[model samples]
Target: MEHVRPLPTYLAQRYHGWKATTFAENRAWYKRLADEGQRPRAMVISCCDSRVNVTSIFGADQGEFFIHRNIANLVPPYEPDGNQHGTSAAVEFAVTSLKVAHLIILGHSSCGGVAGCYDMCSGHAPDLEEKSSFVGRWMDLLRPGFERLPAEADETTRRRALEHEAVNVSLENLMTFPFVRSAVENGSLSLHGLWTDIGEGQLYSLGISGEGFAAV
Candidate 1:
């Protein structure tokens, strides 16, 4: 912690510019949000990929959505073993406390985390195979999704398949939490699965039947 470095000059300059422009334009709105508190309607769980922009994609303003990002956007099954579960904690807060109307699992194409999971599960990543690898363990949540892919497809197709599966897997796991299931059963919450092609700027959403993703 003591070895932490200051922000890069370029990033600091960008921040200053944003503070003087975007932040300045929304000063009153920001102040109002600060005074009134946030009441976001949706909670988006997305990949921690730098290319994926949750707010920009939706054209959302601040305080509009509660966003949580993690590797591959995977969510583990409901576990109350008293361990530190960061993603689960966020989901718990969003569903039980914040009462978000929607919970969306957003996955994207060319996700390195998904790729890593692919490598790890395919017996190609020995480092990740080690028990001490945190990323390896976190990515294990997506293995079921990866395994469901047809063994005949090429690597690219399988990778994309796994990416979409990541979203579905998360949606299913989200329901395992009692609070999330209660919210959905009571009509207070809806679950969504989405995938994005970063380079093509194309977005696809899973159908109501959960068959496959369709262009949106």
Candidate 2:
């Protein structure tokens, strides 16, 4: 379990094993992304969880979706880090450079980060912040929801509610970006919120409208 299989060889083989016949089918994608300059029509901010692959779920080919994923699918309210607004930077690029028309925040069921926040809220979770750690800071983004969510809710319900709240939080944060805000106000950009349940192979509904969460 120490040193594993030949990763480099396996990766090379896998890349070559793609279902790509003509060079135009595969290599042309990168060329177009670079030259066509990546003018995708949609932007998706999604969870970094490997189980959720944005491109695959959306059935997107190359240059179709501008995606930036993070832990818990979070979008921290806009703060200038001089040059390090990780999520904000991507939002800017998607809005200004790519001119993406849609900004979708995709959340899913069984997110570990949401579970971590829930556990931390219950006082059963240990504080790892005594030492400088990334997970602690990442969980910090969900702190407000953890503190504000009702205590009587069951674990499953709590996680689902957190997913909903987190998406709403990101949508609000999206407005903090100048480009995104203008596009929204100008009616050029639209916001759609989504939740994916991996186990049920189902998608729920929710929106800027009052549809709430219906199965899709």
Candidate 3:
């Protein structure tokens, strides 16, 4: 308890504002959600970027999405080594427990995690390449994307390409889970890949057929 700190004045003020505005207007809805338990139709896996606003982008009300955020919106290949796997646990809960109708991998432009992976793979960020770096270890999941990128592309293009590839990689990795694969094959669940341009407010959906990402 000694390490705990009080909320900053700005955040406290914003909480009060939200409580008075959004909470007050949705009081009944909130109470119903609390009483009935959540039955979210979709599970969204996205990056921890502050710029990515899943609720705002989808116009989703509270309790509509089971969302999980990590460094790069990545889903590692299924590993049953009996170790701690946060993403895998979330996926299992969403797929098997919640039985969500859709699972979405939301990637974005200018993602720091993807950029870090690019830099690390390009031999530009030595710190991230260190063995003890947790971030380095996590970003290793994106190495497949880095490998898939064009070798001679310019920095800007390569980074953006890798961002797209990150979504593709996550989608591929999602199928590695038997539960997820079974659900998809039986028409119980569908998978989607989305990429966002934060600055331009544009969104693209990756084709289910592996053709190309199309603006949506």
Candidate 4:
């Protein structure tokens, strides 16, 4: 109890403001949501980057999207070893319990996680190579993407390519889950990958051929 603290002053002020305005204006909607439970239409897996606002980008309101954010938005291959798999559990719940019709992997430009992965794979980041680094181990999931990059590509090109690859890798790894595969095969679920350039506020969608991303 001693370790627990109240919300910061700024956060508390913002929360109170939201309660007075947004919440008050939509009190009935919020109450309905609380009583009926959430029935989000889609599930979005995105990066933990503070700049990427999934709700604002889509103009989504409460209960519209079930979002799961992680480093670089990476999804590891299906590993049901009965361990603590937070992302996997989220996917399972979203697909199996919620029966979301769409599952989206959202990647973005200038992702720190992807950059760290690139450095680690290139052997420039020795600290990430250590066994004790959780980030290092997690970013290992993106190594294959790093391997797929063109050998002659410049640093800037490689950086952007890796960001797209993060989305591609996640989309591919999502299929490794039996539940997800089953849902897709049954035509109940559809998978999509997207990348956004933070600087330009431009979005690109993975092609049907899964070869490249195109401006959307």
Candidate 5:
């Protein structure tokens, strides 16, 4: 790692411009949304990793994508817990309130959370009893992905296998919600699993056939 702190000259300059322009843009868009009561077209479940900015990736302006980001981009099975979950709340708002038509679960390569999934499957996960970080708990949703992989596979291959399979699990979990399932059955909503290769900017979407994923 570089021992020096990188100068934020470019970032500062960019933010200064954005602060002015973004305020102007939001003011107009807010009025439009209020007047027309516009609804978002899609809701995205994305990784909370700083590197993967979903809105920016989609070139979205303000309210284009209803977004929920959490570690590993996980979707827990529908449980009306007495407590509020950030992701769950966003899903509820997007589906029931905002009436988004599409829900996208985006998984990316080189994900630390996914690496944690690989670690969990390999039986080398960090102790959760210590309250290490949100990632520790959030990543637990992916534990099942590990169980789905072959036990005899080598570590490197196993992780790659788990990464792909984890996307499949995330797609399955999306339907566990009553509203999400109902909407799909009623033809009001569509769900998709997408794999993003940040290193190459390639997006692969799981096909309807359920056999192999195809490039988007």
Candidate 6:
């Protein structure tokens, strides 16, 4: 609490603006959501990138989707060793508690996390390679994806491939959770991988074959 601070001036002004306009206009809807709780049909796991706007991209209203954002949108393999796992906890709550039918791993272009992983794996980022770097350990989840890339690939191709693979790796890790696997096996849950080009605003979905991404 000592470290907490008041909202910045710009954010306070924006909040007042939204409160007077959007919130006031949708007062009844907001009340309904507060009273009835949320029943979102989908869960979106996206990156902690300011450029990627998940709700705006899907035209989703509040409570329409349960979303979780983390660096690179990566999901670590199910390791129920009793350690803290924020992403895993979100996935469990979404699937088991919320009963979301669809789980989406959303990746994007110019992902700093993916780029860091690439640099770390390629021995270009010594800082990230240090054992004490949380980012280094987290990005290790994408190392397999990095290894999957061709040695001859140029920078652009490698970065894009790793971004797509971040989605693939998350989808695979999602299945490793017992609850997630059960939900999928029972047909109660589904998984999807997606990537977007920030510059072009074009979306691409992972192919069913898991080999490539196609424009959506």
Candidate-wise lDDT, in order: 0.94, 0.79, 0.95, 0.95, 0.80, 0.95
Q: Write the per-residue lDDT of candidate 4 for residues 1-216, one digit (tens) a residue.
A: 999998899999999999999999999999999999999999999999999999999999999999999999999999989889999999999999999999999999999999999999988999999999999999999999999999999999998899999999999999999999999999999999999988999889998977699899
Better of 3 and 4 by TM-score: 4
lDDT of 3: 0.95
lDDT of 5 by residue, 149-204 (tens): 87788877777666676678778887888988899999999998887888888888
Candidate 3 local lDDT, 1-216, one digit each (tens):
999999999999999999999999999999999999999999999999999989999999999999999999999999999999999999999999999999999999999999999999989999999999999999999998899888788889989999999999999999999999999999999999999999999999999778868999
Comparing 2 and 5 on lDDT, the stronger one: 5
Q: lDDT of candidate 4?
A: 0.95
Give the per-residue lDDT digits (tens) of candidate 6, residues 110-164.
9999999999988999999999999999999999999899789898998889999
Model 5 regions lying over 4 Å from their true place: 1-13, 21-27, 34-38, 128-133
For candidate 3, the TM-score is 0.97
10 residues in a row with least lDDT, candidate 1:
138-147
TM-score of 2: 0.86
Q: After superposition, how far is residue 116 of candidate 1 from its true place, in Å?
A: 1.2
Model 3: CA > 4 A from native? none
**lDDT, candidate 3, at 84:** 99
Q: Tell me which residue pairs clash in candidate 5.
A: none
Poorest 10 consecutive residues by lDDT, candidate 2: 16-25
On lDDT, who's better, 2 or 4?
4
Per-residue lDDT of candidate 2, residues 82-182 (tens digit)? 85667888888888777888988888988887777777767767774434657767777777777666679877777778877777677777778777788
Q: Residue 23, candidate 4: how far off, in angstroms?
A: 0.6
User: Which residue runs of candidate 4 sit more than 4 Å off their true CA positions?
Assistant: none
User: Candidate 6 has what TM-score?
Assistant: 0.98
- Which candidate, 2 or 5, has the higher TM-score? 2
Q: Which residue pairs collide in model 2, if any?
A: none
- Candidate number that wins on TM-score, 1 or 6: 6
